[model samples]
Target: MDQRSELSEFLRSRRARLKPEDVGLRDHGRHRRVPGLRREELAQLAGVSVAYYTRLEQGNAQNVSVEVLDAIGRALRLNDIEQDHLTHLAKGKAKKKRAAACRPQQVRPALQQLMDSMDHVPAHLIGRRLDILGWNRMAAALLGDMSQLPPQERNLARHVFLDPASRSLYVDWHGKAIDVVSILRLCAGCYPNDPQLTALVGELSVKSEEFRTMWAAHTVAEKGHGVRRLRHPVVGELTLAYETLKLPDEHDLSLVTFHAEPGSASEESLRLLGSWSADQPVRTG
Candidate 1:
């Protein structure tokens, strides 16, 4: 991807999503040429000259100061993910050489110990491509037959969109699909030249219309606290709160833990599922 073009389009798309009234601008009540605030209006809000802001928007953002970038991000009403993307664009880091191919990251021994200790909570670790590097027994049971997938096809994002079983297993499949695409968009910005990632994009674009549409939106996301609803074949419906923690020394590896809200029926279901998983034989990855 051309960094300049990508940067320009990303900024323009973000700008077009904001409204003048959203950032305290007085409405003129006349038909406007653009959907969002005009160039001068955004410049005024960011406390920068219109010419300078225009240059930045045109992808001539070299040497932009942190203060100026922050101002622009605030003026644009960017969320955490968007703000991070803005910083990446300003630094022109997308032009960096491809990362040296390294062995797939393994779950650390301590992490495995932690997951094993959490008998009731479902926990797993995933790589940048959403491959399940490792998981506790509880998590394994919640996602049936996932371990049986070929190594290359074990990725959660690919399985969710390409495998029929994944769609059937998730109760709110559409919501998860959107989240997956958003996360992939964020990954794309960080690794624009990654051949594997590019190949994944091409495959999904050809295989699923929904993936193609969502990818075009240029959405980005950060892993954080969230809720997930699952329809387990053995345990029925389950609602779980989850948190994702990034692992240091590993590029794009995250440990995710799922918890059921206290005293809820979901909690009861989780207990039942955990018990069932314990009874089943362990799976080899």
Candidate 2:
């Protein structure tokens, strides 16, 4: 991917999502050619000249200062992950200096132990590309036998969007899909040169129109905590709060765990489901 082109397009897309009224500009109720604030208007908001702002959007701000970047970031409403991505692109250090890092063959032993210990809650380990590294019996049951997929197609994002069954598995499929694509965009910005990531993006972009549209939107969001609602074939609908913790010493691995709030119907459902799942045979790759 061309870093310059990516940077330019990302900036322009973000800017286009915001309107004059969004940033406190009074709508003149006059006809406008574009959807969002004009170049001069944005530059004015960021306290920069039109030429300087235009140069930045053109990916030509070679000597841009940190303060200036921060100002532009605020103007564009860039989130934490988007801000970091912008800084990284501006510094021109996207290409890996060393050989591409090797992907892990399995989940770390400690993480495996951690997942196993969560007897009632569903937990799993996944890579940056949403590839399942490992999961407990509860996780497997809740997610519906993902191991049945070919090893290469075990990615959550791919299965969720590309596989038809997944459409009905999630209660709120559109919202979940958006979150998946947004997280993928964040990962792409972080590892622009990863071959595996590039291939995943290419495959999804071609295979799924929803993924393609969302990817083109250039959205970025951090994934740390959220509530997920799923319709399990066996257990009916379940709503669980999940926490995602990035593992130390591992660049792209994270531990995701889900638990229903106490005394709720969801919690009762999870308990029954976990008991049932624990009785099933475990599959190991």
Candidate 3:
């Protein structure tokens, strides 16, 4: 969870993905020891000195200006999320490190009621570290039975990486795994000193090679909106549109909901799943 290491790796990974030709630098077909743009090539593209760029890449963001960082980000062709992540890493060193909140996360009664009102939609309130704080019966039906899991084990990343059933559940399990790692990377940048996050990363790295590889890539992401394809054990194939709603609270919790297109086969499958979930015990967590 070293911020310096994270910064350096993020920058290095970004740099390694770019080529001299990508930034209008002519590749003079010369022998090179590495792929992508070299440090000097990146500095030239960013309109900065090699030494200065090297120092910045070495995690020395002390007194670095936003313009300089933006220049670097531009040279790397960073997307919006990547640029935001770069900015977070650069400016994060200025803040004092503090321990992560130790309190257990809980869903507000109002929010829980709101989730319950969505009878057919699958909703889960996800807290920091991708912890599944609260979930509705529909979510439990679509996903697994979270009520049966210990509170500590109800996490999206853990479920994706550790659970064997998750592989078959997600149609594109590799993509799902990458998304989990990217989300965790975003969380890590926001809270570098979070012991729980550190432990989660360590555990996944040791247990799953795919998690380790994706985590090393440092692809940061924000929960927004996307489509999810799943092969449910009971309902067969389904395509669910996922959306995240951020909660206004001390804990960084967001309600994630999945929906199916109206009048589609997926919606019918969802209805069947809802019916199946109705008979099973409702999720209490």
Please identify model 3 stretches exceeding 4 Å from their true place.
Answer: 93-103
lDDT of 2 by residue, 20-92 (tens): 8899998789788878778888899899999999998998868899899899999988888888888877766
lDDT of each: 0.81, 0.82, 0.88
Per-residue lDDT of model 1, residues 1-285, tens digit only: 555666777788888888878998887897898788888888999999999999998989878998998999999898878988888767856556356322455777888888878889888887875767788788788875457777777677887898888887888899888888888777777767767777888899999999988877777886677888898888788889999988777758898899999999999999998888877986734
Instruction: Please provide TM-scores, in order, for all candidate models, with all chains considered together.
Output: 0.86, 0.92, 0.95
Off by more than 4 A, model 1: 94-97, 100-103, 279-284
lDDT, residue 216, candidate 2:
92
- Candidate that beats the other on lDDT, 1 or 2, i.e. the better one: 2
**What TM-score, to 2 decimals, does candidate 1 have?**
0.86
Which scores better on TM-score, 1 or 3?
Answer: 3
Return whichever of 1 and 2 wins on TM-score. Answer: 2
lDDT of 2 at 197: 78
Superposed by TM-score, candidate 1 places the C-alpha of residue 149 at a distance from the truth, in angstroms, of: 1.4
Clashing pairs in 2: none
Clashes of 3: 0
